[model samples]
Target chain A: MLSESETMSRFFESWRRSIFDPDIPFRRKALDVFRHQVSHVPIYARFCDTLGIDLSAESDDDNTTGSDDDNTTGSDIDNTTGSDIDPTTGSGINPPSGPKKNPAISQYSDAAIPLMPIQVFRDLLIRPDYLTIPEAVFRSSGTSGSRQSTHEIADLTLYEESCLRGFGRFYDPEQFAVRAWLPGYSDNPNSSLVAMIDTLIRHDRSGLSRFLPLDQPMHESDFDDIREQNKRIMLFGAAFGLMDLVDSGAPALPSGSVVVETGGMKTRRREIPKQELHHRLAEGFAIPRDAVHSEYGMAEMCSQAWNNGSGWFACPPWLKITIRDPQYPMELLSPGKEGLIGVADLANVHSLSFILTQDRGVMRQDGTFQVLGRWDHAELRGCNFLMES
Target chain B: MMQSDGQITRICKAVDAWLGNESGLLEQARERTISDGLFTLHDVGHMLEQVARTVTCEAITAWVEKSRDSYAVQNSGRKDSAVYDKNVLCLHAGNLPMIGLQDIIATLLSGARYHGKLSARDPWLLDGLLRLLQKQLPENVITWSTNLDDFEELRADRILFAGSEASVEPVTSRLWELRAAGKAARFLNRTARFSIAWLSGKDVEELRNKTSGAESPGLLNDLVEAVMRYEGRGCRSVAVVVAPCELSDVAGTLIPALQDYVKKYPFLHSIKPEKSYWASYLETMDRDFFESGPIILTGDTDLMGKEDVVCWISGDAMTVQQIFEKAGPKVQSIYTVENPLPLYTEALSRAQKPPIDWKPDGVDVLRWLSG
Candidate 1:
């Protein structure tokens, strides 16, 4: 048995290697991490057990919900919502009110791997008791007046590495002066996005990189001067915050400067379509619509996916995106099919690696995905006050 | 100035008169609500019909008759009728457009000195109606205040608040404060709640016949019409679908049905994309959650506590019963398709047929309001 520090160090090492190994099979790494987490993370382990996926057993437990083998024969059909077959169970009547028996998976597929509901992190720290105490805790913004999700990191160094490498892989940091107008996250030191941006700023090595203060308006002249200096700039702001800057008569930035928008308008303003928002930002910044980037991330995962003006986002090498049929969690949707997003971030080794998100998106053949909006049933959590422009 | 029954009849007649006129205050109210994006013009028309039916002389007469027979207050009130004239401060929730109109009418019929604080979200519709009522009734009979503090300042013997669950505590505490200060009051607090619909196979089949076609999963159309009314923002809206055990496969049929219906009838007051994104973000983090079009299906039976609006829950009869037990006071209405109404009688304040009135949760306002 290894000490907690040693176990975490091993995960970090695996992540570092995986980032450089794109050719590595997704499932092989995912399954390896899944099996490891089942033994270490209590919440995740219980979830797998409930789903009847026992890693330690001679074979993966095949306890499936509803009657997949013979949908007509599974549970007694009773009339509640008028004889409509329950989507999940072939026959309804609550499956005999006892523990769900393990149903055999005909084939060993990635879908068979049990997923931890993403909400567990919002209400519980995914930290196992045997694991080392977390050195830092990152929280989602609670601007919506609901409780926010918090990610406890046993190893801050691993997170720093993940953020820098994941970002550096997509866009070169040294060439750009990272100018972020992320007031909501920046104000809260525990914010993961703020910490990630801080890393980007530090990596820029230039004094030009900094989070702009909300109260103090940066004159257009100052921004223009930075462009004149021949420095590439990445301007990041919350969607609504960026809207405010433009609405306040802020002139277009120098060409080639990247404007990345993260958090949505929330309740600060009436919700606008992403196309309209991007167009407005592009028109205001004098940049191509594609020049306006979107960052898809949350406190629940260790990795962030980036969309460079294309409506679709692509995850980094260590992170994988899986679109699953919302009604059937075990069923994976093909490319171009809209479904719920399931993320398997190898960098999330310290916590639960498999996270099923509430975002609705369509995966393309090339693996890039476009987020449609929210799954209507997803609960709105916390205040997004800081995102208001 | 008039007998309670006569005063109620006059107010009902005034509303009917306004509604009948092509260019009356009711029309103006309807148009304003449409323009405000609170409800679509079609749905507003639907809401007006419910309002019209609720205040009819027939409905009022039957209600008064029932209350006189059932309420102890009525039997004893003739000797000590002073309580009948007590002031009732009405705090109307604006979540559902014109949701306060029923209560406003009820308060007036109770012969209480009705002072209402209308929801800011929907100030125009009810205000227009009230102003029309003032034209026929004396000023002493009914009135509305501009602000909560002003409503609070006026003399009141009873308090009636209809709002979100979160408002319950603060309102109660404020009333407590008022009582501590020597201004005591009796109260009825109606908080946020959602409704459920239970269907049998026969019900699904009939729904199919009435909508689209025989094999097209007509229950989906029925649910969409019920839940998506007012964009699923109102308490009367059917938020949860409780189905029979054999119909577990209904989830699959309903998901696609929802997608098609939403595309056909776009939400008038749709949720903002940003908030939707945040909600999705929060949901993706949870394992027990799943989505099917506008309907979210969850294995977590206790979703009522979370106020999960617009979702379907699958369970056996016993599981659903347990859920109802757990959901207890939060559940407002449970509509059963083929099952007997008595099956859910205990679970709800009143188990009625399909088209339910937009009443406050946990209370039968008309029953208590009529004397």
Candidate 2:
């Protein structure tokens, strides 16, 4: 008999069948995962307690706390504010006794779930209490001397599976020799991007995958070997690192090869817009402009959004993106409106699924989105500075 | 100031011309300032007027001359020009319009090269103003950029930064490392803070007694201006008003003043509904709030509230002191009408209109730049 506590079983089944099953009830699954995390993740449960979100009580699907739920039309979220914060004891509310999985309690709007700020991962150790032994800790690539965000992984296989299956949605990782040219990232063992790339490269059944040498001349012999093996170069790199490769004269690759630019260059090179950067990379790498791809991911998130040749990025079925009003963070903006980006990744279940990122983007009606740029005033938030610290 | 040198005179001329001109750069600056989203067109208008009125040549000359009397703050006529020819980088905050004006003036009058990284919010106006002065001054007088890479890479002989504590700590840590390695200079850093207004029971009683049928209370407009200015985005803008009695006791006096403020700035009445972020949060929590359209009086109790929100706390001397004690380094200034304060306290009106030599975060930037 299959135990009811087997939560990962459903997630893995969904992950395997989600590509083919277009009619999967994402809301129900998201709500289930959200309820699961609220019960098990201590840090997240504590945050929710501070927000006065009562998870023990069964809630309606669209029952938002505020009267402004009518305004939250485009996204799955409805704005939820804190309720009944204990005055004397403060927000020192403890987690529920144990993980309560009730069939009748599978209901919650997106807003009912609090979007933890990305900084929380940096300031505190966030993981499911049951799984105290983190398989790995992936950190952000911050500026020198800056505190980077640490994402403690409960399961390494979960991440590898998320990477391989997520990548497999677009292209077969085996057919393409997964070649990555990450300069700032490759050296760091804690870099999630590096880990993701490493995992993808390792899964390359052709055995022609490797990290390209940095700041050094790319040997034609290496390219010849890939060319000899009749495999396409799935070249992945940080934007600036790729540009450095372009400047150092990246050799022309075989046709059908892809150039993936992980969006960044803030500290390294003179910054350029994503479109202009893509065009330059396409020209420099001797690939068709359509072959240049952009990815939207962060150390705080489990899944990555991919852009095909255009500026717009498409999320895999497991990920949900919402555009939120920057000033009125509680209200969700309609489609075509530019606002701060909020992500709810099902794969991020081990930690917290919902995250309010520092990025600004606009989501189209088709679930595709375009990352505008970093919101500088994203630091305007100063609520409960102690809690934040 | 420095015997009214040719460059200073030319800079004064540039200021005069820039201030007098109507629809050119000022209009461009006004548009840019409004686009920052924190400010409105009317707010930009008032800010420009404030800047124009206070940043006159005489005022500049007086402040410069007074500072020079204390130290050998020579920039131009130094026989050892290299010794005094230091580059000062001013990484400014965007809370107020031309907030770094005093810093720039100090750098220029001290004869140091001014390297600036303007806050993205109020860049166009300051950039344009500096360019006007730059045309009349030496080529190396000013240089600035809004690029992230440039900011991360560029370092100077001296640094003046005003931002949040979170932003400053890392920079401070990096500077300390650099200094230990003998690669950095002495610097002054100001982090995020807010001002508060303290109202005694006597003060509230006075307002109540003075209130008649048609007229408002005494000096309340200026006090209201403290919160009304820049939508309370300035560090000196009072975010908290501590009254010795219940807010209901003086609601008549306080509400009308706020109403008058709304009359003065109709934009406050028409604030985007989406901007009621704190208000919504309070409602969802089912907590009591004293809301006035854009200005919310919530229990946030923050040292600095966001955009247009303010905190209203009722307390006696000890209670007020407790609030200030909790504030610590985060308190920028204390504003009061009658009661005497030990230090770092200003008259109610001066909270909104500080003097030319006003030391932000109690640090005399001019003294540091000159000496």
* Per-residue accuracy of model 2 over A1-389 as CA lDDT, tens digit each: 33433443443343344322345445644655666677667666655554545566553333433222332322222211111111122232232343434412233455445666665676667766555467788898777455888888775776777777778887876568877888777667898888888888788778889888765777556677778878787788889988888888878767888998888767597777777888889998899999999788888877888986766888877778888866666567888876789888877767878877878788888878998776544134221111110
lDDT scores of the candidates, listed in order: 0.61, 0.66
TM-score, cand. 1 vs. native: 0.50
lDDT by residue (B204-289, candidate 2, tens digit) is 88766554323654566666778767666677777778887666676676666776677666653245644354454455444456
Cα-based RMSD of the predictions, in order?
Answer: 18.4, 13.0
Model 2 misplaced regions, further than 4 Å: A1-22, A59-112, A172-175, A378-389, B1-228, B234-351, B354-371
lDDT (Cα, tens digit) per residue for candidate 1, span A1-389:
55545544554554456534565445445544565566567777666554545334422222322232343222221222222222223232132223334432222454556555676777787885445568788887766565788888766777778788878877877667888886566667788888788877777666778878777886766566467668877888889889988898766788787889885666378767778889999998888898999888878877889997777899886788888766454557999776788888877766888887867778999989877665533122100001000
Collision pairs in model 2: none
Which candidate has the top score in TM-score? 2
Candidate 1: tens digits of C-alpha lDDT, residues B1-371: 11367776787777887778534777777778778886677667766776665667777666555555555554553553434567777776664444466666666666666777766666667777777677767653566754565544465777776544334544666655544111666667664355677766565555444434234543455565666556555555566666553323454455556566556656654442322322343354453444533445554442442322454555545555765666555565676644764444322212211222234554556555543
**DockQ (Cα-based) for each candidate:** 0.03, 0.07
Q: What is the alpha-carbon lDDT for the whole of candidate 2? A: 0.66
Clashes of 2: 0
